[model samples]
Target: MIVVGAGIAGVACAGELVRAGVPVEVRERGRVPGGRLASRRFDGRPTDTGAAYLTADDPDFTEVVEGWRAAGLVREWTDTFLAYGADGHREVSGPRRWAAPRGLRSLVEELARDLPVTVDRPVTSVRPGPVVDGRSCAAVALCVPGPQAAPLLDPALTAATRAVGEQRWSPSLATVLRFPSRRWADFRGAFVNDHPVLALVCDDGDRRGDDAPVLVAHTTPEFAAGHLAQPGAAGPPVEQAVRDLLGLPEPAELVHVHRWTYAKPTAGGVGTYHLDDEGIGLAGDAFGKPRVQSAWRSGRDLGRALAERLLTVGG
Candidate 1:
């Protein structure tokens, strides 16, 4: 079996297949995996720009993340999260959120261990044996977004997937703030439900339990849309929006902006899809909803289904 996309869904799927005694190759378009839960280096420091944080309430998700935590790749974060609403700011308790020691992307990286993953290989198309470039495979699993998946499939499958549409992914603008000294914020993270400019302000440095000297602020969807049309628009307005959200008299030392065109899945079909004739399957967070836990479940269920099918085929 072959898997496209080395993100959470792809890695999880490939891991399942490999453990099931199936040979799998994971292909990724980017240099590294983790898709939206991405990380980058800034001023000699690394910070998480995608998938700021995630909480798991589902038992299945807990088991999967627990495996990751036991591997020393993930850890538990405090439950206290402050909410800055119209009334005022107050801390609240909720399910414990888990974070990777290095970054959320690290979890994906760890899961991909021992798996043969080829980076920088963009899957232009998928077909029966002997496609473009003379590549051949027995089975394929597509972990890309539904819209992107439509074009790569056979004509018959294309029509069925086209009904799913381009799948409008919610846009997001992340602004990272660098501070010389630690600025005290009640708790590690704050949620802004009814704010105009900022949506969430997070002390990722403290959240990671590292003295990384960094803070991150996210803009509301409306705010992100207003300026996302332009490529470089995330600079000034992002700074202004972060300042407004912080409700601070002064700005920080420096600010950085990251724009995600396909941030999260807004819509997907009824459930996951598998084409027996095509000898492949499809799964992603976009398969249902845009959450890490949802993605994990999607991959697990898809992997199980594919394993069952593969067994029947082999037998």
Candidate 2:
């Protein structure tokens, strides 16, 4: 079996398949795994520019999160955030959000530790026999965004791919800024509602459980779409918004912009996964809610179903 994506969903699926006694090979287009659970370093400090945090209400997922907490891979961030609007800002409470000391990507890396993942090797296409990039395989799982997976699927699975592609995905631009010191007010994070340029901002220092004076702000989907072709251009407006929101005196020491063309799915997909007799499967956050936990569950559920089918056929 070949899983073409090294994100959490892909890794989770491959992990389940391997545990089910199925041989699996993972492929990723990027240099590293984690996909949207992405993290990077700026001036020797790790920053989370992708998923802000993980929230769980489902019992099974909560169990997995508890395990991650026990292993010291994740920690409870906060259940409250400052909500901002034209009127003003106010504190709001919600479910517990989980964060990683090393970075969100590290969690996915840990899950993929035992899997054989080939990075920087993207699958060109998925043929009818579930062939992956011209290599014959019993099955192929495309664990990517709906729009991205649509093109890779063969004509025979057009109906499946079309349904998968129907889900709308919104783009986002994340702006990371490094301040000289912790001059901003004490707040773990803030949700900027009714803002034209900004949607949310996180105190990276607080979220990462470190006092690094770093901040990461995400642009609204509408704003991101306008500057998709030029991500860097979105940095200025985002920087201004951050400063205005936080009331910082000085400008950031360093700033960077990252674009996610398929940041999130607007609505849940048709099902947990799409699998046909041809052995081609589609699984990702698009299959459910646009969250890390949903992605994991989607891939895991699909893996179990596919494993059963393969085992029965082989028997």
Candidate 3:
């Protein structure tokens, strides 16, 4: 068995397969295996640039969160987020969001530590017979966004191809801003509604629990769509928007931006995963809500199905 994409979902799937006694390997196109749980180092500090935070509600996923918490990789950040929109600025309560001290990427890495992952090797295609780039495997799992997975899947694989085609994705730009001091309110995160440029903003210092004057802002998909070609150019407007939103007294000392072409799925799929007789499986956040826990569960379910099928065939 082979899993493509080493994000939390992909890694989770691989872990299940390994436990089931299936020989599995993961191939990731990125240099590292974080997928959407992306984190980058800025000024020797790890900053989250992809997922803003995570929440655990499902019982099974909550258990996984407990393991992370026990390992000191995650901590409860906040349950309330300030909403800014036409109505007015107000605080809204939601699930308890979780953050990582070493950055969200660390959580993905921890999950993948025991898996056999090959990084920086992009698979060109997944064809009929469930072959991955001409290498035949017992089964193939494409754990990526619909837009990304669609390109790699051969048209002959109708089920996988059609499923990916039905998915709608949106893009976003995550900008990191470093300031001289923390001048914003005590809020940890905010959701900006009806904003032209900003969608969400997180206090990285607060999220990291380090008290460093840094902010991470996610741009609205509409605004991000215009700057996908050159994400760096979007940094200025993103930083400016954050500064204005928080009424910062000074300009940021540094600005950096990362683009996510398929940052999120417009809607969730009817099933947690898709597995066809062709031995091709599909899993990701698209299988459920666009959240880290959803992706993990999607992959988990897919892995179990694949393991059962393979074991039954062997028997």
Give the C-alpha lDDT of model 1. Answer: 0.75
Backbone atom clashes (below 3 Å) for every candidate: 0, 0, 0
Candidate 3: tens digits of C-alpha lDDT, residues 108-181: 99999989999999988999988888988899999999888889999999988888888899999999999989
Q: What TM-score, over all chains together, does every model reach? A: 0.88, 0.98, 0.98
Rank order (by TM-score, best first): 3, 2, 1
lDDT of each: 0.75, 0.89, 0.93
| TM-score, cand. 1 vs. native | 0.88
Candidate 1, 160: how far from true, in Å?
5.5
Give one digit per residue, the lDDT tens place, for model 1 in 1-315: 788888888888888888888888888989998887888777766688888877787798788788888888778877888888788888888878877768888888888878999999888877654242257776788887766667776665553355346465677778888766665544688888877667777887876778665777777777788777773566666666655656554666777788876678887755754445556577788776678887877777778778777878888
- Could you tell me the lDDT of residue 256 within candidate 3? 88
lDDT tens per residue, model 2, 193-253:
9999999999999988878899999999999999999999888889998998888889988
Candidate 3 residue spans exceeding 4 A from truth: none
Q: Which candidate would rank higher by lDDT, 1 or 3?
A: 3
